[model samples]
Target: MKPFDFVQPTTTDAALAALAEHSPNVRILCGGTDYVVELKHGEQSPGVVVDISRLEDLKSIELTDAGLRIGAGVTHTEIMAHPLIAEHAPAMIEAAHTVGAVQTRNLGTLGGNLVTCVPSMDSGPVLLALDAQVTILGPKGSRQMDLSEFFVGVRKTALEPDELLLDVIIPTENLGKPAGFIKFGLRKGQALALVNAASAFRVEDGKFKDVRIALGAVAPVVMRASKAEAVLEGQAVSQDLIDEAAKIAVGEAKPIDDFRASKEYRNSLIEVGTRRTLQAALEAANG
Candidate 1:
């Protein structure tokens, strides 16, 4: 790993200041699950590394007026254990459990997963399905954007070089929303997803409401299967409709041919994953 100046900041303000001082040369470190590997591999060579692990403000999981607010530094293990997350967004717990292993879960932050912006990240699908938003802190102060807008491309995000992601919020309306997540990988554990999917909706008068279906690993970024969702939205719930929507979802994605799986195989996974997740969400809505 290349040598770099390290600054451990105890407060969010201090961390932002450090980032501002170092500007484009600075890199923020939270859980270090992803960035550390990059550093060791010589993919990143920042002049300064600001460690925000000690920043208390970025380690909370609370029910704010806006929604369920999860600090950027909260680890995957924390998400798996937190009562608020379990109550408001149980599907997130399942998603968190699929991340790496026990040690990686203990050290991997949700923010880190999102910030890395990998297409197959376990956290992306559910967050997108739940309509989560991200808060960012920078020299000009704070700004917020939809989680969908936060991701730019492969290994890239909208976060400015001198900005730090603060927290992610699942809107109050989405809290307790019925949702389901699925990750199809080469192995049962510690495997990258070939296709991961999440689906969320509410059943009202036997019709689907606010339908959302998100898919990862089949595109440049995790993306909502809007056309598939449109197929189910306001429609009477039926197994046939779900199967059709799942097929529509496959058409919406642009999966590439890769070593882990072929494009055709991923397309099959996308269809099955979408169907299963949607079925799971339907079951949740029913209960």
Candidate 2:
């Protein structure tokens, strides 16, 4: 690892100040699961490392007027255990569980995972499915944006060098929205996703409404299957519809040929994963 000064800030303001003072030359560290590895591999050589892991404000999970605010510093283990999250967005728990094995989950922050902007990141699909909003704090106060807008590309985000992700909010309208998450991997234990999917919607008058399907590991950013979602919205749920939509979803993704899996295999997984997750979501809605 490269020699770097470390500053552990107790408050969000202090953290922002640290970022403002040293950013571009500095890197923020939360769980260190990803950043630490980047540091050790000499992938990132920040002059200063701002550790916000202990910033209490960024670690709370609670309801607010805006919606359910999940602080960025919250850990995967915390997400799995939180009663509100369990009750309102259970699919998120399933997603968090697939992030890594127990040890890494214990140390990984939700913000870190999303901020890393990896296409295969497990935390992304569920949040995107829920229409989650992200809060970013910078030198000029804070701003909120759609979670989709937060991601730019592989290892890239809309966040500025001096801005820090504060929290993510699942909108009030989507609270307890029926959703399902699925991840396909080679061995499942600490494996990067071959293809992962999430489906969410409202069941109204025996028809699907506000249907949303999101996919990861098959695009530059975790992306929504708008074509598939369009097929389901305002339509009656059925096996045929799900199958057709899943096929449409395959067309939405541009999966890459890689060492872990082939593009063709990923496309197939996308179809199956999309169908299954959509079915699971429909079941969740029915019950």
Candidate 3:
């Protein structure tokens, strides 16, 4: 790894100050599960590395008036074990479990996973389905945006050079919303997703309400399958309707032909994944 000036900030304010002082020449380091690998591979050469792993402010998981506030520094393992997460967003735990293995889960932060902005990231689909939002802190102060808006493209986000992701919030309305996540990978473990999907909705008077379907690994960035969602929204919940929506979801994605899988194969997975996740969500809503 290239040598760089390292500053371990004990507070979020200190971390933001370091980022502002260094500006575009600096990078933030939290769980380092992804950034450290980038450094070792010579993909990143920042003049200054501000380590925010020690900042207690970014390690909390609390329920605020706005919603469930999950600190950016919270690890996959922590998310899987947290009562609030399990109680409010259980599908997130399922997604967190699929991220690499125990070792990677131990060190990979939720913010790091999202900040990496990989189209196949395990964390993105579930969060998107639940309508999560991200908070960012910079020299100018803090700002919040929908998770869909936070993602810009493959390996890119809306975060600025001197900004730090603060936390992710699943709005109060989405808390405990019936949701399901499914990932199709080349292997059972430590494999990147070829197609991943999540579905969330509420059942009211035997009809689907506020339905959301999100797909990943089949586009430049994780995206909602809006047409598919439109198919089910406000409709009577039934297996036939879910099957129709899943088929529509396949048409909405733009999967690429890659050595790992063909575009055709990905399209098929998208359909199956959407169907299964929706079924799972339906079951949750029923109970």
Candidate 4:
């Protein structure tokens, strides 16, 4: 790696200023789990590295009128340990636990995971299923957008180089909503997800309501299975309906043949994963 300048701004304003000053030439480093590896391997070579790892402004998990506000700098381990998250968003805990491993989770920030924008990122599906929104800080000020819109494509996001993600909010209406996340990998530890899926909904009067399904790794970006969601939503839950929805989800994905797994294998995983996550969410709702 080439020699570069390193700055660790102390305040949110300072961070924003640093970004505005050297965005295209600078790289933000919080939990270096991803960026550090890139720097070492020459995948990224920024002229300036802005370290925000210790910035206290971006580390909190609290409730708000809007919903739960999860600071971008909040680590995966913090998510897994936070009592509020455990009570209201348990599926998020399950997802966070699946990230890299104990050490990586200890060091990785939720913002870093999302900013990395890898399709198979473990933190994404559960949040997407919960209809989360992201707040971003830029030179012009702050802006909010649905987490769905935050993602652009593989290793990309809607975040401009001059902007820094501030926090993630799970909308109040979806608080404590029954949701489940599942990731399929070749082995139990540190394996990239072959296909990951999440589902959420309410069981009202014995019928599905507001069903949501999000999938990852099968496409360029993490995506929702709206077609599959349409199949069982507002309908009475049944094995037949679940099976059909799973099949629809399979059709919705565009997995590609790769060394880790074949497109055919991923397609099968999508069906099974979507079905199981939906079933798990339904069971949670019922209980």
Write the residue-wise lDDT of candidate 2 on 17-122 in tens digits. 9999997899999999998889998955699999999999899999999899999999999999999999889999999999898989999999999999999999
Query: Over all chains combined, what TM-score does candidate 3 have?
Result: 0.99
RMSD of each: 0.8, 0.8, 0.8, 1.0
Highest lDDT, which number? 1
Scored by lDDT, model 1 comes in at: 0.96
lDDT of 3 by residue, 1-287 (tens): 98899999898999999999999999988889899999998855799999999989789999999999999999999999999999999999999999999999999999999999999999999999999999999999899999999999999999998999999999999999999999999999998999999999999999999999999999999999999999999999899999999999999999999899999999999999999999999999988
> Where does the lowest 10-residue lDDT sum fall in candidate 3?
36-45
TM-score of each: 0.99, 0.99, 0.99, 0.98
lDDT per residue for candidate 4 within 69-103, as digits (tens), equals 99999999999999999989999999998999899
* Cα-based RMSD of candidate 3: 0.8
Candidate 2 error regions (>4 Å): none
**How displaced is residue 196 in candidate 3, in Å?**
0.9
* Model 4 spans > 4 angstroms off: none
Give the Å error, residue 178, model 2.
0.4
- Candidate 3 vs candidate 4: the lDDT winner is 3
- Residue by residue across 9-127, what tens digits does model 1's lDDT show? 89888999999999899898888999898889985579999999998988999999999999999999999999999999999999999999999999999999999999999999999
- How many collisions per candidate? 0, 0, 0, 0
